[model samples]
Target chain A: MKTKRIRAGAAAMTGVLLLGACGEGGPGGSGGDFTDGKLVLAVMNDQSGVYKDASGPNSVKAVKMAVADYKKKHGDKAVVDDIEVTSTDHQNKPDIANTKAQELYERGGADVILDVPTSSAALAVANQAKTHKKLFLDVSAATMELTGAQCNKYTFQWAYNTYMLANGTGTTVTGNGDKNWHIIYPDYQFGQDMTKSFTEAISKAGGTVQGTIPTPFPNDNFATFLTKAGSTNPDVIGTMQAGGDLINVVKQFNESGLKERGIDLAVGLMLITDIHSLGVDQFAGTMFTDAWYWNMDDESRAWADRFRDETGTRPTFEHAGNYSAALQYLEAVQEAGTDDADKVVAKLEGKKVNDVFLRNGEIRAKDHSVVHDAYLARVKKPSDVKEDWDYEEIVTTIPAAKAFPPAEASACSM
Target chain B: MNAVLQYAVQGLAAGSFYALAALGLAIIFGVLGVVNFAHGAFYMLGAVTAAVLLDTLDLTLWWSLLVVPVLMFAFGVVVERLLVQWLLRLDPLYNFLLTFGLTLVLVELVKQKYGVSGLPYKPPKLLSGRVDLAGVVLPRYQLFVFLFSVAICVLVWLVMTRTRVGMIVRASTEKPDLARALGINVGRWVTPVFGFGVALAGLAGVLAAPFRAITADMGNNFAIILFAVVVIGGLGSIVGAVVAGFMVGLVEAFGQAYAPTYAQILIFVLMALIILVRPAGLFGRKEATA
Candidate 1:
């Protein structure tokens, strides 16, 4: 009798469950998941190649921190459900980054992609995101073509580009009367773009490019390159290289004994992380353009400390940019109330943001290039370095409007 | 004229590294009949080991150079015994694939320990700064590298051609059947020969650390060039490897001077042209290769 009663009860419960299941094909099953009211971000970057340390897997950590901070600050307003971060190492290849970006959008369900370093890879990811109509926030790639020929509605380079760098460092050095330039550039698209940008900037500042040398990327030695630079007897030896290549180039440049001969060095782009690696003594009095510096102010230091605690290393500009881009993206999604591509993009466009990430940051509606002040920084002398991470001393701030190329000059139709 | 001199010096210096690496490749190919594709990885390992020694033990360059090669030599012996020896009787292509895979494993291992951005190795103070070569300026350390590497090469050559060890190695390599028949167990020398070959690669790595970007991937570009040097030198000929190393270097140096962009392509192009002219290479004996 007891068994029969239990069987009857189970049948009744099954009928109720079937009725509840049959009523479930309602508004929630729209298939427009939109990260399920989540801000899903995908980070694609060079994880195991030359650009690994400059911006790699640590970028993923930076994005996650942005998510955490967004939740803590805004509570349920940041994401309707939660923020999710997914990442992959692009290995400094464009095709790989593109495939990964596609996977992130189609399968991983990511709303934004951030922290791609190498120019080629970053450009590829930017284009891919545009085709998919998903947001791409480039953190560390330094190419001008992204904002020029390749600028899209969805792609926004969060960090520095070759043009801005060329403007800040190239113009300043040329303005100092160090004419007759000998430019040594890594023979790649980014390097080529930099060479063109620097030439234009130097001409504007009343300087002549005496000669240009194209060097192999990821060169083993720069002693020969430096010797050739010295051979030309130019007033300035401008190096259009960065990362490990930059480190080798700068080290050999300093040791080439050319400084005593009235030849100055002009680095197109530099980071505090680079200074820390190459030793501040080697770069003392060396002026360069930087997108951001960690110890820029009281607020930045507090944030950097938290970043250091998370990454176990001082936050590079790339790391800081990743955090900023991620946070801004979350805020844009929140403002839009949904992860719809058109709506979220509209919210981000023409938005003037003043957050821990951006000082007077304006996401220009025309081309989606974030315009912000870039710093003119000098490498602190050995005696001036107060701590291990203390490397750069801000000389002056180049306003966003001045630092970035105008729409007419950039010719970005989007 | 000054630029020519600079290119020549630079080319010759680069050639010296190629020759150092090719010497080991030639030895292993001669004794073991395998290409030892891991030679470049071994070279990189030598550099990584030296950098680690300096970072952890605060060891000086000279001492690390001494210690690194021996450690690498022993390491080569163990690898030969445990892994390489198992595939000795197989086809040469199999061994090539094995070593190629080994190179990736070794490179990845190093990358895991030290992040891929590369670590800096400071050159000794004695070798810092540029040396005024009367009218032209050359780096003091580079000049030292040219001289030091040549000396080590000579020492290696002397040991191969002059010493009792050389005699045994020659006999075992020249007539393995006769060597075994004459109460000389040729098997006993295989480990040492493999060890010696990889040791040379390790030594080249030590010599390179101060000059090149000491990273996990540093060996990759050079490894391709090293193979070309070996082929141009005539498969297993030590003297050929030495001669070709300098020749390729000179070609590269002069190429860089004239054609900076196409210099790397110029190397492989030269290799293809040389093969068309001499199938067994410039110094290779036709019958031996056949």
Candidate 2:
């Protein structure tokens, strides 16, 4: 009888502890139950599709590393001890991303979701994050809609956007006297945004878009499209495609005598790994906007070496962005002493953070657009490439303000 | 006139690959009475094998062209013996479904081994440049692909028509009971015939490696088009499959060149029209009941 009574008492205590943990939005709270301080970060991106190499499982590794780095730096003074990181592959689909985003926030209790690549999928998550009042840090997807029309308080886009690419590459190329542009874009939100932004950027810089071709996503045969574009023979052929499609487009474009006809090839947005995969010879003399290059400096190289050991590949800008975003979120939670959405958002807005990955990183308060220094890199010729990954030569550094459009231009009501 | 000629030539080149792949599909369907959904995956395997051979083994494109098909043939034989032969006596749907599962398994296996990123592959130096006919220039690789595909088709035709082994295999597939009653061991030829058909798909993949983005799911992209080609040409008609392959290719190319946005519907529309006009396909034999 005495032992039974003791067990009953223990059971009651366990019940009370469960209540404390469930105090997140429950009635029994002192304003709010900040008792259970657990940080769960979920990486949401393409893990087994075209965008996988750029972000995917590597992004998960990057997040874990950032968490480790955060703990090492703060030690006992760290934000939270109970931290967990998880991931889901969206497969570049908007519906799947929405479902995963909901599960991550509602059931899994993720504090932040990182690295959604496809714009349509990212937008879906962005809307879900806003509705759920959760944090989403998009490290890769390029649609400016994230910070423009669809932007929300809980979502922050960390890397380059379509506007940044348009301003960086489109305007630069136009200013260099490539007056006529033929833009071939994948028929998706991201690609369409790239086309729109690039067209506006070029026209504003005194260039005319001769034509815009909306090609199928994941299109392998760009031969006919190339021939048609070749017939027109515009001064510049702007490829607004990404991943495997981009590789094919660039290859066919080069082989179609457009270059011999003196038409320049301008990639609206390109990852470093793409140039590496295609080799310096194929994309030589091509120009594009780059978010981050792994071999940019000693700091970058050191981080990249660690990343290489982890992933067996050099970290692309998207992968690096995941690390930086995770670290920033942790820092914000530490500064605010809470992982509450409002508190974290307040802590992140307009704060200048510096790390190996981002310099002068400012998460814009209005549209939650993280702005940092961007660069324009031109593909190095085969003779100039000293190493395998030595594909791009940094042409010019773009200031944060100049790279991104003004915040007022954003249609986001946030 | 220049645009028309350009689109035509380019379309024909793209069609050649579809033709090669569809020919393999037709042969398998004809002999096995099974729709091999793994056809595209086999094509992808061919391309990836070439990539791995070049990147890891330091082998060249020529070596891949020479060796990969033979390796693929061996793989097909094993797959046929272990998996496909078991499903032969069952419903045809069983093999169809089995091939579909096998395709998924193969695709996932490739994804696990080599992540879903595109790999780089350079063409042979001999086929690297453009050929100028008048003022317009076309890629030399495309021209080579066209010529090589035509040559392969002719060789396949000659084998089926002239050679003893090919004649026996063709006769066995077409009139299995008759050939079996004539004291021929028709069962022995089944495995080799399947392997030969799979090998043809592998060959097309090797040819496509230099042009398409060398990736695991690259096959899925081409597979849908190849299926349309097989359907339009008739399910098991060799002539129909080859002709339909080129026809679909030309249709897609012209569609993209002219319509651009609506090209997705062009091939399907053509398929619908073809089905309406010729129920057994342009080359498919009419049913005795009909």
- Predicted model with the maximum DockQ: 2
Chain A only, candidate 1, TM-score:
0.90
All candidates: DockQ: 0.50, 0.72
Candidate 2 chain A, run of 10 with poorest lDDT: A23-32
The lDDT for every candidate, in the order shown, is: 0.80, 0.84
* Runs off by more than 4 Å, candidate 1: A1-35
Backbone clashes, candidate 1: 0
**Chain A TM-score per candidate?**
0.90, 0.92
User: lDDT per residue, candidate 2, A1-414, as tens digits?
Assistant: 446434534543464467642313322112222323367899998888778888889999999999999999999987577678998989999999999997676556677899998888999999888877888999888888889878888999998899999999999999999999998988888889999999999999999999988998778889888777756778998999888899889878766767877888899878877876666677888889888888888999999999989988889899999999999999998899877888889999989878877776788888888888889988888899777587778899898888888888889887
lDDT of 1 by residue, B1-290 (tens): 87888778878877876787788998898778888899889999988888888879998789987999999999999989988888888998888999999999999998888877676677778888888876767677777877887887788789889999888888887888898898888888888889988988998898877766677887887788889998988888888888898888888777667777666777788889889999888777776556
Model 1 share of native interface contacts: 0.42
Off by over 4 Å in 2: A1-35, B288-290
TM-score of each: 0.92, 0.94
